[model samples]
Target chain A: MNTPGHGQEERTGLGTFADNLRKVPRRFIESMFRTGRPDSDRSRNDFVFSNFFLHVQSVRTHRWSLRWSTTWGLGMVALSSFLIATVTGILLMFYYKPYPEAAYQSIKDIHFVVPTGRFLRNIHRWSANVMVFSVLIHMARVFYTASYRKPREFNWATGMFLLVVTLGLSFTGYLLPWDQLAYWAITIGANIAQSPREVTDPIGLTPHFDPGGLQKLLLLGSDEVGAEALIRFYLLHVMILPIALCGLLGIHFWRIRKDGGLAKPEDADRRLGGPDPEAVPAWTAAPRKTWSLAAVVRGRTPAVGAGAENTVPSMPHLFYAEAAVFMLTFLVCVLLSIVSDAPLKELANPNVPENPAKAPWYFLGLQELVAHSAFAGGVLIPGIIIVGLGLIPYLDREKKGTGEWFGGPGGGKLVAWSAVFGLGTVLALEAIAIRFGWLRQWFPGTPQLLITAINPGTVLTLIYGLYSVYIVRRFNSMRAGALGLFTCFLMGFLVLTVIGTWFRGPNWDFYWSPSQWPGH
Target chain B: MSTHSEPSPGKPSRLDPEAMPRRDFLGIAAASMAAGACGFAALGAAKLPKAAVLPSAAKKFKVTLPESLPSGTPFFPEGRSVVVFKDGDRVFAMSTVCTHLGCIVKPAAMGFDCPCHGSQFAPDGTVLRGPAPKGLPWLSVRSAGGGAILIDEGTVVPPGTKETV
Candidate 1:
């Protein structure tokens, strides 16, 4: 209360001294936080409003936005995983050396000598893996929910950049151990990065400069993975990528605020059909209690329609939930660290290359693409996917069904058809490629560019193009088209990753079972 | 939150207060509990487990290549789980034991193969395929007295005793 200065008039000298003594700690705390006492509601609000860390959060958030069902806390989990990875990565860095000669030994020493060293390293490894997984799921959720509409399009683009940065970080870290897995995986990746040359090098298509080869050179610092490559990758993994991710993440969250927080169904409805004349702003007339957003999202959705705006302060609820999730993630990481060991091989020997060398798992999809035609599979497809993801907001500009799964109307059926069609096409192409080995065998002397373009890539392009056109025509909506294309991309990626990781055995040949791999 | 009255021209004076909302009290209580929990967690984390130490003896070994070994052939010592490769004129000794779980790998079609896991090594001791995190060790191979190859398992040293043909 504002009664503090006047209340001193009634106190005796001794009572005044006691009161003043109590004020000492209060004054100190106030000096530190630059805020009021938290006993009263006014002071409690001030406490959050004045605090630097808490002030980044919105003063209040809509009730529907808080539903665990809606988001599954994926974004938070991804950020949490990043935090764990950063901390554990730093701890592991104490012992890690980024030279080909020393890296593997250093890793071995970490596992054998440093007592919680292996645990910390394992956490870092898992955190990187899970962060990528969580981000993929988060992107799927955002895409399907149609959260990237209108003003949020750029934010979605920022999210795309964040995903790329995440992949970059995961990849650069792969080479820090400098073991066989690290060496060959990165070798294959570097080769894939140069895949565009598969097209440009032949047929006199060379421009003034070669950017693809330049990129590969920059990444490797040479023609191959050696000391220069090791250092370059280490710098990228430890320094550049993390900084980029952090900066992009800041932009991403800030854009969420600028774009009016997370997407909601009613937002889509209102924006799409113009505002309802009868609908009133709910927050201005308060003391009218209703269900929180978290409640209805957990299966207590409003009976009649979307209810009054359910905005709640971030002082406790938002902060608590975030903190709890972070703690839970860290605890889970610790348990996983205790149970598992990160793989570390013997010293790197450049003379001997892994016959079926592969890239890090996340890049396996691209690797699978490169296996067919370096340019089409690696350079062209992946580049298209990344560019396509970035351009989605501009491409799908319709405001209808912006925040509902696959556009919320006849969306379920559209999604089913799209999935079936997309999956079937991808599997069929793969089946043909496996059965005939057309790309490998049929193209005896033809240039790689023509063969790559004709076989499989052409099939993929035709199927996808037809499927997208069908989606738009059948559903008579742009949202349906967007949903279909996205489903195809995601489903294709998953299929390729599965095949590359499990089915392909020795000499990059397809095997039905991993156990069937003919290894020495 | 911006609704604090300033003793304005309204009927109620500063003394007549309205009822407090449940969320305000809940916020204060939750904040305090969170603070206490953080404090305890910090105190607990202050004492980490003891740092681990590496055993010095198992860290290093010395192996001399044998004269009987041919070029590109791995020489397996009678009792030691180590293979020394004599490539042309150069000598490289590698541990036959899988780096993964320490299981001894036999020569397979690729190079060296782990039976426990599907880790395959090339002839020169690098991973051809892996569940293995690393390649086979390229132990220091130097010319030694009477052409005998001395082998070390865990760590590498410059081959003081290299085999001379």
Candidate 2:
């Protein structure tokens, strides 16, 4: 109340009655944001610390964290899209019916009848898509920055699980519309769930121990996608997965705080007791200048004597930056929603399947693998990738260039070459796999187990592994090897996803372009 | 309650309540309580999975072939995933469910084409082109005494097994 700005606001408002009306809003603002305006350093710190929502973040953020190039704000964009999806998804729940008979019709009603329903649904769909894309990019950013190295390793593992949960949420939501696209896509998903049969059946253990059948049953709640599966997916998409995501996200954010904020070059420099050539100029000058009371007494805290040398308060700087990224994400999703209607295909018919029934676009890459060998594509390869990605931080223990993109200097060239090598190898392998068939064609009666173990997915994984080892020996650093390996996997995923989405046609047959598809 | 209990030979000990250590007594009591709680939870959970009402359709269905029906053309029964055909005096039904991944296969010019992963099957339910390790399964069929053919989807007949009509 004593602040000059507060008095000036009171004087500018019309007389006592109008001023009384304005007081209500001012009081509301004051009560919610106790630090008011965040004009001074003290107020800025108090602003973030006093607020429940903003408290998870550090009161003062490293300047690097505020830089658009440092993190690209991809994580914030993902969080924004998720919030949009949750809000819109809840709104959709009011109108959506989960029964098979009513589901498709209700979606039609949502599209054409309910006020703002189409726009809301479109936004939900687009934001979910945005979340998936941004999450992938965010992970790539974290990896390229080498932020997962030590003290932040568990967070990386948690992030991988979060990725799974995200994909799970998206996949489960796909079946809610109950259109041909939804039905067929889920059918493909169910089949993928049952892919272990490729190994089980060949070994004659299917009758005794049928894990794939159990998986399929659990996923669909029956033999196929029907009313039962619809309700199950509805429960998962709207409730279970979201709850899991919230819990994991809480850990993810908290871990970042506990790890002494985002990784920076200064941290490694401080550890090594040498001036990092790449360290921000201010960091070297104010090495012992710390504002935290913990600096006085702490055993092995991540930042026992860390200094806030080149940092800005979270209130106006970081908050405004995050808000900008969030707004940009929302704007992009909104524009996409306005321009393109979310697809609603014909009603689901079990009798007549779509010519080339495909899973959700994100899963199409796995589906492409499934075509080669169901067990390999659907189960084994994805399993290996998940476990491998989770183990990355633990495996690569390099401490130099912690926060620099591509782990500083020569890493850029290494990554670029790795990307080219990855893209070329995948393209060549895909061409070979398509033109000349795999083991099944070469050997008239190749066992399913052999094919499952030695398909294109396995080949790609093996090549990536071997090449990564070579890069390690060549560069004599695990980080360089990781950069090479991660780049290759990224490129391979992109290429496969592209092929699956656009190049593959009816009967899962390959074509140079969609235009060349038969009957197109 | 018995005021005195015997300490049995070859057993660690079983005596009056006063003789039992507090730690062991509490541990045993807590374990039993936990077990009881878990048992009740299991009992409640066991009832959740089994549906009170059965699935809408039955496994076995009846279909009558037309007098002038074509020999080789596939005839799909209503609400069923089986395709039936009559060749001369022999009648047979094959499952439309793809052996590869269980997608309902569509009858095609070559034989049957799976839309999910493109596993193809010959007319006689043999794997022509695969990802499908085996072909579409032939369902057991029997005449229902009135030109009506009864197909048992639950039963998988051998590849060439046909009903004589």
Candidate 3:
């Protein structure tokens, strides 16, 4: 084990055989790994290129990407979180049972009986939450940077799908514990999904003799969340969503290579007019050939004019970035696990329902919206958000601010304005509905369709739409308008979620302060 | 390769960019603070004997309410501390324990109030807001003879019962 100062520096003659042990690994690394030379660029590139596991990363990466703020290392952290989740989830599965009767008891045993099972469950729970959080943050980074430009549109769309898949994973996993908290959370989610009836009722629209029931049917596998729903969620959480997410995540990562590495600033130039592709001169001087190629054989395919400054090989630099993020996530999860517990309430009893039945925190925003109208927050808005986000790369196709955040000069200002407008609108609508409730109260004879359509939720949405259209026309840039509107939407989500998580009391009624809650 | 790409995606690319002080400083600071807080909390928890965390609070609460609770009005017994709603034949009893932070709720005009977080409770044990997951729980109440309404606060029973007059 001797390696100079490291271990057993001087070995006696009989033990000399073991003294040179470090040499065996060094030789193996040189021969097999090719990274024994380490610091040299060639060795670094060879290390990534030769290794099957890391071959997906580029041999070299732009130094700009290494900055933590650029992507916040979210993509790497999310991947690490997912891996941590998978390992812990597997550990939990060994002790958990899918059946309703056994599920709650099993979770109890994991907390109390199994060795370190609580820690494993806590890691799984927190890591799952963190993965979803990081994925959303990653998307926001991509959106703000306008990285989803033209050719990258497909990747952006796939990323949007991945986000939905990530949400699905969380929602499905919510039911496994089978406590009152888990059971009702899923029940509320399932009910919310089924709420197309509320949306359809507004327009006197029948979903082709009720296609509205389809979503509920698909999610619940029955009329209500019960044994069937539990099994269905378990299957999807354990089997379907992970497999789907993994495959799509693979595509999402691979497309980065295809679409070109992380979006660079100059990508903006590619959108608008740029330094004209070095004037191509006709090869009239090529004397002999009928068919001739006068191409200036580029200096290294991807490099051509790519100057070498911040470019570092991904072998160690990026690999280390991924490793660092993973360790950080692990340490944080451990610390959190040690201090807090994943919550569990009484065993699920269908007979006894939670008064202010709620969904998971992530879906609580929609639940808050649902308190006003099941369709708008749960059905329509969420649907539009998913579809709209997917189409964003294609919608605001301006090359000018292709890779720039916010969009242009006043981009940041637009974001603030949009966020304020969005938040103010939600709060104002809630306040108005609470104060007057004119549609539901004063006008009893009015058709529910009219009432639901013009209700506070719908009205505010329309107002925001009009405001954003005005923003677009005023700004003269489609990208600027998109930035404003998207920022507003993000802020609105936080507002609604905060209300749902904290301020709303039983029956989903608004409370101005947490102290005002009727939970005496 | 190309030292120029865009302007480093969103930010202005500059000399000594990765060292662009604020972001890294904030990130490291936040991470350490969170880790430190968690470590402190864990250490605090470990230092305490298990009983300190889960105090053996007297869970059983037996309250005797006056025979008549003005119909539809919330009545707090003078000596006993449970809130009972006795409307006509129906009688429901609720503990004043704020499920959120364990603050005792005092009877208010319309409902109950926990001064600690301003969590409001309806005449029935519904949570209005400060912050907790669920509403106030209803404890079991059955009529005992001789104007004595026996209330058991240990068992959690569902509300909406019809106490036939």
Candidate 4:
């Protein structure tokens, strides 16, 4: 029974034809991906350089890059998810209309009529969630590994821009379904955009210099979310953002290559206190391998003259790892898509608002922040975070640990302490805010500026900032301090997001569960 | 690029005829022309938002009060962002647009409740619970010589102002 092809009776007609037909696909893949068998280093190099997709990657990858624990393949997962979303999203666009009166009906038709349409929409949706989640984790991985050091600083900035684009894509897409969820979420978004009026109005500057009004107009294309807003968001979600992402992604990958293919310790060359280099013979006979032509060109190729001691050809090693991650992402998204349909609620009605209307899950944390003060939560905190995250590589210039998780043992301890402090403070403040209420409750008639300037959100931000400063003073290391501050912000965001998603009921009031919600 | 035009730290100001080089002058001229072109383009772009034509529902409409609408009970007119109340012969209309962010408010047992941020307003359009800086605006109302009354949503009347039949 175990013998290969034991049940097969050698067929002369249709079976032989079927066997040959099966071989056609394998041959096609072979022709596309390989110049020859990848058994030798030269063949593997050919496999990488000759293929269009593989050509973007280096001929060889460092051993550190191959470790599952190093990157967890999160970047690969994000890219895979993005690819899936693009394919399914384009398919969806074939049926979707960008008018207020037609959008909801179109979505319903896609759900009920179009063959495999629900599955396609679900895949697009779940993959979008997967992409956002994986991109976040990838950023965390980069931060923890201190991969955004001197040479990769600009790359890190590029990553921040890409992050914003990702969120923008998600947000604009959120309004497309034109359901209650989509409508209210975008309404909240529009309101958040107008939060600058909270400040401008207080100073009597709104009449002459109304940035908030301008923003809302640009975003919605009118005073409210209507046909114009729908068309504008549709244009952005499908065309502009995706194109911008592709351009930025090109720069990101190019920068990665220029930065010498991911950070590693100085001892990675195996000439210092590190382990002995692999015994495999070199691809080229030079004592120190280099891309001579690339080095002679205008820009410096850092990988050139970097000895290939503990590196292997990327064709099978790195390619296999990347392909495995892609498959995993695809499998997970498909499974989730099959099990759960993407949400499509009642048609959007401006006259009726969903009780406790909430923003998309990713922005729920900011919504929770908005509960304290719209300006502080919606505008100021997000502004600070974007600017802050982008400036991290520049701010934390210490070069002690470049490729280690949590930047080594001491850094891990700092992250733990910071996380605990951040989570504890946020929880306590939320509880107090819920129980005793904020400045508005305690001191009625408080000016909007005072309320906007000082709330739980601002207080938490100030605490985290000062704590980060103190950590820097105590440890005398910018990396350690940056680690602390980043961890704190991350923890706070996670906690607030959870509370906003689950605990807040109608009127944004706290409830233990959905069962406790009024009229539920 | 500006090195030629920069005065050295210890040198006196250059007041000579050739103080600004031809290269610098030409560069400035080209840049200014480009800047002027951009300004004109921006001026044209600014006109895009003002919307030459606006399609909106009639701001003033006649609303007939239902016989079943109890005194002091709010009655919502079809296809309008307004709530009208009648008590005996006195009648008033209030804009349902939430002052916080212009969300349409739903009438509650007590008053109007905003669904956007939970800004509540009293029966007389006074602020009850707020992120709403002010209460809902009272719309101008006038008797139309029949059971019907005209509500002008485009016009804002003083708070508590009412029209008598």
Off by over 4 Å in 4: A1-39, A50-52, A269-279, A283-306, A408-410, B1-52, B67-71, B87-89, B143-147, B163-165
Give the Cα error of residue A343 in candidate 3, in Å: 0.5
Tens digit per residue, CA lDDT, model 1, B1-165: 568856655455658665567999899999999999999998777432211222123523445555576787777766566777766766667767554323457787778875433456878666554333346665655444465544445455443334433
Question: Residues A1-520, candidate 4, lDDT per residue (tens digit)?
Answer: 3424556665667877898898998888887875767786766766766777666677777777787887999988989999999999999999999998599999999999999999999999999999999999999999999998878899999999999999999999999999888887887788778889989987899989988878887788777788888988998999999999999988888777667787776655543333235536443544323333222212222244544556677878898899999999999999999999999999998877877888878889998888767789999999999999999999887767778788843578888999999999899988898888877678777787888899999999999999989988888888877898899999999999999999988877888998998883
Compute each candidate's TM-score over C-alphas. 0.68, 0.86, 0.67, 0.86
Candidate 2 docks at the CAPRI level of acceptable
Instruction: Name every residue pair that clashes in candidate 2.
Output: none
**Between prediction 1 and prediction 3, which has the larger TM-score?**
1
TM-score of chain B of 2: 0.74
Which tens-of-lDDT digit does each residue in A281-339 have in candidate 2?
33333233333531222323334555544556677888899999989999999999999
Model 4 lDDT, residue B151, Cα = 93
What candidate 3 gets wrong by more than 4 Å, as runs, is: A1-37, A199-208, A267-309, A513-515, B1-165
Better of 3 and 4 by lDDT: 4
Q: What is the lDDT of candidate 4?
A: 0.83
TM-score of 2: 0.86
What DockQ does candidate 4 have relative to the true complex? 0.30
For all predictions, the C-alpha RMSD in Å is 16.8, 7.5, 18.8, 8.1
